[model samples]
Target: MSTEPRSTSEPRIAIVGAGPAGLMCARVLHNHRIPATVYDADTSLTSRDAGGSLDLHADTGQIALADAGLLDVFAALARYEDQAKRRVDQHGTELAAFVPDADDDAAPEIDRGQLRRLLAGSVPAGTVHFGHRVTGVEAVGDRYRLRFANGGHADADLVVGADGTWSRVRPLVSDAAPAYTGVSFVEVRFDDVETRHPDVAALVGTGHLFANDGAGLAIVAQRNSGGQIRCYLSMRIEADWPRRAGIEPDDEAAVRRYLLDAYRGWDARFRPLLTDTDSGYLHRPIHALPAGLTWPHRSGITLVGDAAHVMPPLGGWGANLALLDAAELATAIATQPPGTALTGYEQRMWARSGPLAAAANEGLARFAGAADHIPDHRAEHQRYQADAAAYRAARA
Candidate 1:
C-alpha cells in the first residue's frame, strides 16, 4: 500500500503481469520514488506455481537484480555447488560435459520458487493485485484503464504489458502474435536425483546435458536445486501435433508413452529419464514472436518482457532479457519524467531486445527440424569465448 506521490504531476503507473519482467519493473519504479501497482491473474504468490530453476546471467539478469538490490537475497537462494555439467548420447557415450564436484561453483542457479518469492516480497505488501487478469487496456478520457475478466477495473497514467506471450495488451501497440516454431517438449521430471533415480543419475551428471543423434531429440537431466533433473523429449511436429497425439498435460502416463514412442530409437540410457519421472508428463509447444517486432509508440502505454518480445528458450535470454527490460524501463522512468522517460525507454528497449529476439529465432531453427541442426552452444561456451579473448589480450 506504499504510494509515493508521483512527482505531484505524473499519474500512477500500472504494470501488468507479475512475472520477472513485471515485478522487476515495479521494483525499479518503487526504488526510484515512483508508485506502481502490479497485476496478475494468480490469486496469491502460491496461487499457481513456480517452475524448476534458472541461471541468472551476470551481464543481464544478475545485473538487473543487482541494480534492484536483490543480488544477495538471490545468492542466498542460489545452488552454488550444482554447477556440474554433462552431455551424453543414447548409448551412454559421454559427450562434451562438465559437472562441478562438491567444491566447484560455475554458473550457479536459483530455484524458480525462491526467485519468485524474492520478486513478490520485494514489492510493497499490497502493490500486487493478484487474481486480476487483465482483459483489455484502453484510453479512458486521458487516463488508461485496465479491464479485468473478473469485472474489476483500474485506471493509471501509464500501462505496461508485461503479461507475457499471449499478452492482452499487445494489440495496443502491434497486431503481431507469436508464430509456431515447430518444436514441442514432452516435459517430465524425477525428483531427489541422487537417491531416487540412480540409473538416470548415472546417465546425467550435473548442471545440464544434451543427447541428440540427428535422429530424434532427447535433452535429458541436470537441474539446480531440489536435486531433480528435468528431461525433455523434444519433437518436431506440426502446430496441431500435440492435440493429434491425444496428449493430456495432466496425465503423466499418456505423455510418457507418447515420448517413449517419439524417442524410441534412442539408446536405452535415456529410459531412466522418463521411466523414473516423479512429476507428471506435460506437452509444451515452443512459440516465438517475429524478430525485430517493434511498434509505433503510443502514449500512456508500452510493452515489456515476453509481452514485448518472446523468443525460444534456447538462448537462455528469455528470463534474463525480461529482467533487463524491467531494469531499463525503470531507468527510463526513474531518470526522467513520465512523458520523456517512456519515449527513451521504448526506443532503447526496442533496439536492444529486437536483435536478441531474432538471434533466438535463429537458435530456434536448430531445434525445429526433426533432427537437431544447430551446433551445441551453452552459456559456458560464451564465457569461454570471452575468456579466450581476455587470455589472448593478456598474452599479447
Candidate 2:
C-alpha cells in the first residue's frame, strides 16, 4: 500500500541511488546550479563494503568527471601505473599482456570508494539524503511522488533511477529485469601482498592478471592501491549450483576445497587465489539486462547505470557508461524543454548504450566458451583488439 503526498509548493528534482551514476547526476546538476536531491538506501557512505578498483576511460568516465569539475581530483586519485593487463593459460603461461605507455591517460584505475567519496563531497552538503529507501514512485499530476520505507515522501518534477541492478524506480518506465549469466565469481582478498604474499604479488604484476583454463575455471587478480590484490575465481555453473551442492560461501574451508577440486588438474600457482584469503569468500553471480532494452516515453522518469543496461563486468563498460549517462542526461535536462528533454535524453542513451550492451553480451558468450575450442592466445588477443577498435570508433 502507498500513501498520497501532502501538498507542497516547492518543486523538486530527485535522483535515486547514490552509486556512481546517481552521484554523478547530482554533481552535474549542481554544477549547473540546479537544485536536485539524491536519495540513497545506504545509511552512510561507508555503511558497507564498496567494490574494487575501476578503470575510467578518457572519452566516457574521464569526460564526465571533467564536466563536473572533478577531473583533476580523479587524476590525482587514479592509479596511473596500474594500467597493465595480462592474460595467461591455466598452466601459468602468459597469453598476452597489455602494457600502456607512461604518457597514456586513456584508461586509469581508481578505487571505487575513492571515486564515490569524491563525487559525494563535491556536491553541496545535504544535497544527498542518505538512508532514504525509496519504496515506490507514483504519478501525481505531471510530477511524481517518491514514497520511502520510513514513511517520508517527496514529490519531484523529474525522477532519475540510478539505483543499480535491482532498481525500484525502473518499473515505472520499463518492465525489463536482469537475467543471470552462466558464470559466477567467488571473490577473495589478499592484504599487503608485497610483504604478506610476494609470490602472488609478483605473479599479478602491477595491474591485472587473468588465468583461464578455457573450460570453466578462471582466476582474475587485480592490484589495488593499498598493496591489496582482489581475486575473482570464475566458474560456469548452474544458477542454483551452490545451493544444490550445499556449499556455504561463508565457510572458507568448504569454498577452498570446492575451488581446489574444480581446478584439480590445472596449474598449482592458481591455488593461492583460492587458498590465500582473509575471510569467507563473496559470491557474485553475473547478471545483465537484455541488450537494446528500451521503454515507451514516460514523462518524469529516466534511468542510468546498471538500472538502465546491467551487463556482465567482462566488458568493463558499466561504470564508464554510467558516468557518461549522467553527463548526457544532465545536459539534456538543462538544455531542452521540460516536456521533451527526457525523451531526447532517452533517445541518445539508447543509441549509445544499446550497441555496447549487445556487444558485451556477445563477447561474454564467445569468451566464456572459447577456451575449450580456441587455445591460441594471440587469436584471442587479435579478437579483443578488433573489438576494442570497433568500440572506440563507434564512440567517436
Index of the highest-lDDT prediction: 2
lDDT of 2 by residue, 1-396 (tens): 333333366446899999999999988888887778899999999997787889887757887898789999999999978877888888998877777767867778998989899999998998888889999989989888899988988888889999999999999989889999998888888899889999889889987887887787787789888988899888888777677779874667787788889889788777788788874688888899998899998877899989999988865788989998997788778777888888888888888788989878876665566653233433443444565466568757
- Against the reference, the lDDT scores of all candidates come to 0.75, 0.83
lDDT of 1 by residue, 98-135 (tens): 54445433346887777778998998888898889888
The per-residue C-alpha lDDT of model 2 at residue 204 equals 95
Best by TM-score: 2
The regions of model 1 sitting more than 4 angstroms off are: 1-10, 99-107, 247-251, 368-396
TM-score of each: 0.88, 0.91
In candidate 1, position 214 carries an lDDT of 53
Tally clashes: model 2: 1
Cα shift from native, residue 96, model 1 (Å): 1.1
Q: Write down the worst ten-residue block by lDDT for model 1.
A: 368-377
lDDT of 1: 0.75
Clash count per candidate: 5, 1
